[model samples]
Target chain A: MKKLKLTVAFDDGDYVVYAKLHYDRAPNLIAAIEKVVPFSNPVRHARICESEWMLSTPYLGVEDENFSYPDPGDISLHRAGPHFCGWYERISPIGTTDIFASVASEDLEEYRKKMGRAWEHPGAKMTVDIVEVDA
Target chain B: MNPIAQELFETGDRYLMERPEDIAAMRSRMGTRGQNMTVQIYAFSALGSSVDAMYLLQEAVAKDDYDFDTVVKFAVDWLSTLAPPADGSQGAAIIGHRASVHYRLDQLADLTSRASAALKQATTRAEVREILQALEHYYNQVRTWIDLEFPWHELAVKYAELMGDPAPRPAP
Candidate 1:
């Protein structure tokens, strides 16, 4: 199955939090993310793009209704859902660097607008990268 | 170590043994005369209900936190008042089937108690393993009985699938 990688950066002083995402089962993964993200209806914002076969949740301040991308595969919140929605991929041929470039190029303008001053800061970085991994 | 759990286990065991005898005697009194389809059907339904109660008792014991004794006592008292007195016309075949089910239910009750005790004392991997083994045996036995008794039931097929057993063959 195709898997996505996500690298998120937030300004909480010295420490930067990076999350990688992989959802083996979409429904369960959606439930897990909802627990962490504050949203009225998380699933609706987190749309599954059929064309790219990727799952995406809205960024913290993104205003667009249809800016869906592949989900960043992270599973730190084990008890967030009924079960684990991601597993480690040992033989992922797709490099993270290439996927990161595409996501940055495609969504950088939206990311800048939403993040404001944080987007321009040297440390202000958030990435949503998709990488295909051996199932 | 809830007193209720032990009480439920004992009560369930006693019912399994006593109820069948009561039904059998009622069958004898009717002198094997009338068909009494209503009584026969009730006896069959009671047998099925008792088996279900036994399984629930096992589940309560497995859960270990519930006051199973009180739950079981209430069930037994309710069943006693609700079940119709056995009529003598009920055939031996029906009685035999009920008896067998009661026996299995009793065995399951015993297994549940033992398994629960093992779980309570399980501080090590080996102890957990032993408890799991006991549970597995109990589950397999119940699954086999259910599959045979209700081959056409959708839940039976679902159970078989969950256990990785082949779907039951269509009734011949």
Candidate 2:
């Protein structure tokens, strides 16, 4: 089986990171995310979820899957506005979210820096796309 | 109406009031400088309360036909406040970046208008509940944006902090 990965590109592929999709745990969510591959949005920082940045995806709507507190590097979908959230550092427990993917450990440092900038200078453009990788 | 909701409606009435009268008061408060985010914040906060009142009313007024009309009246009254000042006096008093303020105001008005239209045709408690739910969603989004994105300075920052996320509650 091929592993699924999501490429999160910021500022039109200037800075990019790969997140391994948790298909085993959130298959439906992953599938829904795949359908919207190459999703583009303006990213903003989360006030409640510390060390997290979010992108409003008003277009994406899917049922909750594997919803729980997010750890650093975990990417999840929050159904309120149906936004996508990525936690780059240990965060306060705000509520549960559908965890579907995670940025690889090696990418955490850069991811943290990139997502952190949103706290001060937000509205950066972010693009997400699904890609196939070796299992 | 629930007692708490009734109290909230009265509070909202004080903040919003009728047009012309409240508009004149608001403009006078803005004065020549026209930079009063404080009053704007107060008005929006009161609107939040009114939205809550509508929700609470729905919870307890499911059996009362008259209660729905009361909720609709309160909603319509508050919705009137979102309209831009008639004499183009809105330029000075707008908080934050002008374009952002204008865009958000328009978006909020659009959402409210749609909800208002749907609410007019609604005949049952379940229908009203759905409308209130949409308004509640809009309120939370606006509140969050105000606290997180609005340019708060000095005392306003305290208010913004106070308005933070309503914290850790499950999203509806």
Q: Pick the candidate with the highest lDDT.
A: 2
lDDT of 1 by residue, B1-172 (tens): 3343344334332332122233343333221355433343444455445444543443454465765455444333323322211332213332243322332234443444444443444454333333333333223323222322221235547878999999754321
Model 2 ranges with Cα > 4 A deviation: A1-13, B1-33, B36-104, B119-172
Chain B TM-score by candidate, in order shown: 0.31, 0.49
Residue pairs of candidate 1 with colliding backbone atoms: A20-A73, A20-A74, A21-A72, A21-A73, A21-A74, A22-A73, A22-A74, B4-B69, B27-B88, B30-B88
Question: Where is model 1 more than 4 Å wrong at Cα?
Answer: A1-135, B1-34, B78-172
User: How high is each candidate's TM-score?
Assistant: 0.21, 0.56
Model 1 error, position B41 (Å): 1.0
Across residues A47-94, which tens digit of lDDT does each residue of candidate 1 receive? Answer: 111111111122111111221233332232211011111212112322
lDDT of candidate 1 vs native?
Answer: 0.32
lDDT of 2 at A128: 75
Residue B115 lDDT (model 2): 55
